[model samples]
Target: MVLILSAFLSSINQVFYAKWVQDIDPFVYSFLSFSITLLFFLSLTVLKSIKVKKSNIKLNNKITGMNSIVVLNIITAIIFICFYYANKYIEPAIVSAIEIGIGPIIALVLSLIIQKSNILKFDIYVCLGILIGTLILVWASLSGKSGIASDASFTYKGLLATFTAGIGMVLATIYSKKLSQAGWSTYEILAHRFYMLVPVTIVFVLNKKASYILDVFQSNWNWIILFTFLGLIIPLYLIQVGIKYCNPLFVSVTLTLGPVFTFVFQLLDPRVKWSWISLSGIGCLCVFVIIKMFIQNVGLNKEKPKGEKLKHA
Candidate 1:
């Protein structure tokens, strides 16, 4: 249930993120959003520190997964930038479908590799299914008849950006799980993640120009605040909680809903048009995602009885 809610909120936020980044500079938006979220978490951290005794303060300072956390934060920043840029160049629905749709498969593969486990036959089959679905989706998006575009160059760049974002997301999920195993609380992870992001974003904003920061504040502050809350703060916290509690593969599979939400939202926008081919591709993608999840669940259930027997013996 928590995983579902986290996925739903995260999916919903993608729509708002796409809309906001259409007008706002991606770097500026990233900076403002992270800064706002960081401030909120910083306040909480400060309050907690004040409430705790001096002797206990050392407990909070003992960071266990510093390397993994740093890598995760870097990947997260890259994902934010890539997502914003991809949404600018590509239809949000297509971008979400291709990028997020492939994440679970990536996470599964990475998990196996990191654990030094032999790839199961089932894993290969599932990977083939995901690859087929992704190829179909990409073909549909690139086909001129599908209404996405005939411009190969533009579509290629968008696809590349979205794919890069997907890789970043997969890595982030795996590392977040690692952090959880390494003894970081979800709040601590979330706070530290943004703390790492804030400085990098500041550098990005400064490199663009000091004026960009001013522009972020001067331009629709209301929308910025709203997007920060709905698109960044809330969804991020939920995702961290979900990652902490759920298997990374399961969490990634649940987040496959992001493309579905993107499609629905895009359907409401008059500017975007969908073709039958693209819709079919999206259907295939969703079907494969569910099938993969079912496979994983069955595999886990089978493993459970064996573990129970071992314990009994």
Candidate 2:
């Protein structure tokens, strides 16, 4: 349920961005959204930690456990920086295919290497199917038959950045899962998730004319609010919750459902007029694969309970 909800929110996230982000400075827009999420999550955690303290909740995470979170934030910041760089050069369809399609495969390999787990033939096939499905969607988008339409030339620098973003996603998931295993509460995990948006901040600062940010706020506050809460924070919190319960590979595959969900949301817009027949058909097969993987993951994790729960979490 957590992963599904995360996927849904992620899909809808594009709608919020479409409504708001297009007009403003992308860097400023991202920074403001990050600022809002950070403040809300951090404040909530502080208050909850105070309340949780009086009740004698002795959560096991050492102060140093936050090291993983710090590392995660850095990686995430870099990933988005890479994504922005690549998106400018690569076709959006290719970008989507690379990042979304490649993420789970990275996770599977990471699991094999870091966890030294035995690989099942079935897992390989599912990952391949997902890759193929994503390629089909990208192909559709390129043909302008369905999905996102785009026109841009691919460059090696852009390709490198795309792979970086894709690989960074799996690495972040791994760290989140490691933190969960260390008994970190989901609230605490998220509370520090965006400690610093180093990449966005640097670019925003360098762009000078930073004063335009004030104008953006004055003009687009409502849209920014919607973008901050619904698009930025909620889906991320859900992803954290998912990491707390499910293995990285399961979470990775689950996140890929965004494309299908996005296609559904696009139908409501007259401009997009639903046309993902091929995408949806293959998406359903991918969904079945996801369900199978989820069932298997659940059975594997049945013995362990979530680390700690804040009423807020």
Candidate 3:
């Protein structure tokens, strides 16, 4: 239920982000959203007086000093920038769908090269299925009323931006897993990431027109309020809380449902047309996930650990 709720919030956030781009500067936009999230999360941690008593809360020895947090922040900032730009150029549903596949693939490839992890046969099957689904989605987008096939220039730019975001997301996920293992609180990770993002955003804004920010402050604050709450506070908090209790795989599969919600919202958006190919792709992935879960459950039951009896109702 947590994962499902988080996914739904994320889908809504996408729409809010689209509207947000118009009212504020992108760099300021990034800074404010992340800052809001950081403040909200940290406040919660303080109010609750959350401790490191739980194994999950303890920082890993590997993530000890500020150095690791610094590195993680750099990687995270890049990922956020890439994602925002991708959304600027492409459909939200397409970006979300492609990102689902990229994270696992990039992690797999990186582990093979650096960690010497062997890719199993089943891994290959999973990758192929994900790729097929994403390809169908893109094809569906192209076939629909969007003139993607006709306008060569816009098509190339949009596709490039979205695909780059996918690659960026993959890198970020790989780095984040390492950070998580290193003992940094999930809150700390996001905090450090926002710290990095804010300064970089300030520099970018200053380079363009530092004075524009004053205009931003003078402008109607309602959009910022809406954007901050919807895009930053709600989705981030929900996702973090959800992941805390859920199996990582289950969380990921639930997130794959994001595209489904994105499609539903897109139907109301006059800019894009609904595509059958993408819908079919999403359906196929859902089926694949259900089968995968069943297989995993069976394997776990068959190899139950000694001294631990399976409880029956």
Better of 1 and 2 by TM-score: 1
Show pairs that collide, candidate 1.
Answer: none
TM-score, candidate 3, is 0.75
State the lDDT of candidate 3 residue by residue for 189-223, as single tens digits. 56555668777766777765656665675584566
Best by TM-score: 1
Report the CA-based lDDT of candidate 1 relative to the real structure.
0.70
Per residue, candidate 2 scores C-alpha lDDT tens digits across 76-179 of 88776676665554444344446666777887787677777655566667777777765665455445565334353445566678778888988888898888
Model 1 CA lDDT for position 151: 64
Each model's lDDT comes to 0.70, 0.66, 0.60
TM-score of each: 0.84, 0.79, 0.75
RMSD (Cα, Å) for all candidates, in order, is 3.9, 6.2, 5.1
Worst 10 residues of 2 by lDDT: 304-313
Evaluated with lDDT, which candidate comes out highest?
1
User: In model 1, where do residues sit more than 4 Å from their true spots?
Assistant: 52-61, 118-124, 145-147, 207-212, 292-313
For candidate 1, report its TM-score. Answer: 0.84
Query: TM-score rank, highest first?
Result: 1, 2, 3
State the lDDT of candidate 1 residue by residue for 68-99, as single tens digits.
Answer: 87798888878877777777767777777777
